[model samples]
Target chain A: AQTVTQSQPEMSVQEAETVTLSCTYDTSESNYYLFWYKQPPSRQMILVIRQEAYKQQNATENRFSVNFQKAAKSFSLKISDSQLGDTAMYFCAFSASGTYKYIFGTGTRLKVLA
Target chain B: DTAVSQTPKYLVTQMGNDKSIKCEQNLGHDTMYWYKQDSKKFLKIMFSYNNKELIINETVPNRFSPKSPDKAHLNLHINSLELGDSAVYFCASSPRGGANVLTFGAGSRLTVL
Candidate 1:
């Protein structure tokens, strides 16, 4: 069974600083995709970033980026210049090719302190 | 316009009662999915439908049935709901072949008393 793991249960960072949330997965399939989602107090799930296993280059979206290490089965998300609006619960998800099902990890509560 | 929409965002019902939640996506996507988020924030895939065809049905209980009348809509009907059924259910959709990126709707929170 493919599983995504987020070791940190809670984390906080000061505004304007950078924070990295760690994620690791165990999967036998070589072809897969990884994602990071954010859920705020409004209870809406928002896609922050995505990474493909075949691509060696990490994925970046504005202030959000991912350090995807396929060999180590790790995909960590980094939020640069964090703001109070960036505070939310972060989730790591994994989806293997041909399997439409997405396995999600227990979320990490992230708080940005001003 | 909302890309994806779900009705009855908040539902509170007694145990043993039956309820239904409806979802519709206007993204012209061919695939739709249902996910359940527990109190601990663990998401579990419950079902998947592609163009009104049932493709993936996880180990959900028989009391839960998903119906896709068209490619754009998927509805979940639960019979004899239990206390454990209290959670937020999300409806999501993605384009065919680009299944990795999903557009999710505002979830429906079900509270079984």
Candidate 2:
């Protein structure tokens, strides 16, 4: 069984600043994928970024990027130049390749203050 | 167009009642999943279906049933709803054979009284 952990329950960052939400996972599977998702008050969850465990280079999507340290079992999401729209519940998820289940962390509530 | 859609965005019901939430995905993905997000925002997988075949059924109660009529549709039915059943239910789909990128629907918030 794989477990994802998000140590921070809540986080706040000033507008236009950067914020990093930490995530760690315990998985015995060697082939897996990590993801970050954002759910706003509207309740629509959207994918932020994803990183493949086999890829040493972290994944970056516009302002959202991931610092994936496979050896350390850490995959943190970094939001650069955060905006008000970035305020949402961020979840870190893990899925083993060829498996149908996704293990999610107890999301972090992020607030972007203006 | 919505990639993944679930009906009854908000469901309010009484205890001991039975309710069902329908989900459909237009992404033509091979796998669909049901997840429950509790009040504390902890998300956990409840069930998964691949091409209408039951794959992953987590440690959910027997009162919660999932039906997949096809590869693109998965419906969740709950019997004897309880206060603990009040939570946000999310439906997601992914191309199972490819990169496991899941696209989720706008969750269905179920409130039991």
Candidate 3:
């Protein structure tokens, strides 16, 4: 069994600033995948970024990046130049390399203040 | 075009009634999954199908049945729905059975009265 934890229930960031959302997981599997998903007001789950446990280097998208510490079992998401559109509920998920099930965290509601 | 789509964007039904939600993906993925997001917004996997075969069945009650006619389609049917069953259901698909990223649908909101 695997579990993902997002300690923060809610977070706020000023416009144009940067914000980091923390996440931790417990998994006995050596090979796995970590993901961050964003659900906006439209309720569409969008993939933010992903990291492979085998990859020591972090994963970075245009404005989203992940700080993955495999040894610590930590995977955090960082959003840069946050805009109002970035306000949404973020979730951290984990899946074994060859599994179809994704274990998701409770989620953190983010608000971007102007 | 929508990569993954679920029909009946919203469903309102009475207790003990039976309902079904349809999901389809155009990505030609071999694996599809059904997840339930409760009122508190906690998403949990209920069932998973690979190439129309059941792969993962969580601790969910047997009342909730999943049917996959093909690799690209997976539908969820719930019998004797209860108030606790009111939640948002999401359908997602991944390219393969490996570490491929999942693409989720807009979600179906089911309200059991």
Candidate 4:
């Protein structure tokens, strides 16, 4: 079975700074995808970024980017120039190619301080 | 327009009661899913449907049932709700094929007293 792990249970960063959330996964499948999702107090799960296992270059979306290390099976999220709006519970997810199951890691509660 | 919408946004019922959560997606995606988020924020997949066909059914209790009239809609009905059933239910959808990128609804919070 594929499993996703997020070690940081809580994190905080000052506004305009940068923060990184760690994620690791255990999977034997070579074809897979990774995603980072943000859930605010409104309880709306929003897509942040995604990365493909075949692509070595990490995926970047505006201020959010992923540090995907496929060989090491590590996919971490880096939030640059963090803003107050970035305060939320961030989740790291994994889905094997052609599979409907999306395994999610325990979320990291991030707080952007002023 | 909202890509994926679910209602009622909040449901509160007593023990042994029955409840249902309706979900619909306007994104024209062929796959829909039901996920449960516990109080600790752990999210788990309950059921999944592709083109109105049951695809993935997790180890959820038999008290929970899911229905899909079409590819665009998936509804979950729970019988004999228990205190442990109190959690936030999320409806999500993805495109027709193997790409599992998902768009989720604003969750329906269920409280079983």
What TM-score results for chain B in every one of the models? Answer: 0.97, 0.97, 0.97, 0.97
Off-target runs (Cα >4 Å) in candidate 1 are B97-99
**Candidate 1: residue B36 Cα off by (Å):** 0.4
Candidate numbers sorted by DockQ from highest down: 3, 4, 2, 1
Error of 4 at A10 (Å): 0.3
User: Tens-digit lDDT track for model 3 on A39-95?
Assistant: 999999999998889999999999999999998999999999999999999999998
Candidate 2 has an lDDT of 0.93
Candidate number with the higher lDDT (2 or 3): 3
Residues forming the 10-long window of minimal summed lDDT in candidate 4 chain A: A95-104
lDDT against the true structure, per candidate, is 0.93, 0.93, 0.95, 0.95
lDDT of 1 by residue, B1-113 (tens): 99989989999999999999999999999989999999999999999998999989999999999999999999999999999999999999988533368888999999999
Q: Give the runs in model 3 whose Cα sits over 4 Å from its true position.
A: none
- What tier of docking accuracy does candidate 4 attain? medium
Task: Give the Cα RMSD of candidate 4.
Answer: 0.8
Model 1, A1-114: lDDT tens digits are 998999999999999999999999999998888999999988889999989899999999999999998889999999999999999999999988777788899999999999
Off by over 4 Å in 4: none
Tens-place lDDT per residue, model 2, B57-80, is 889999999999999999999999
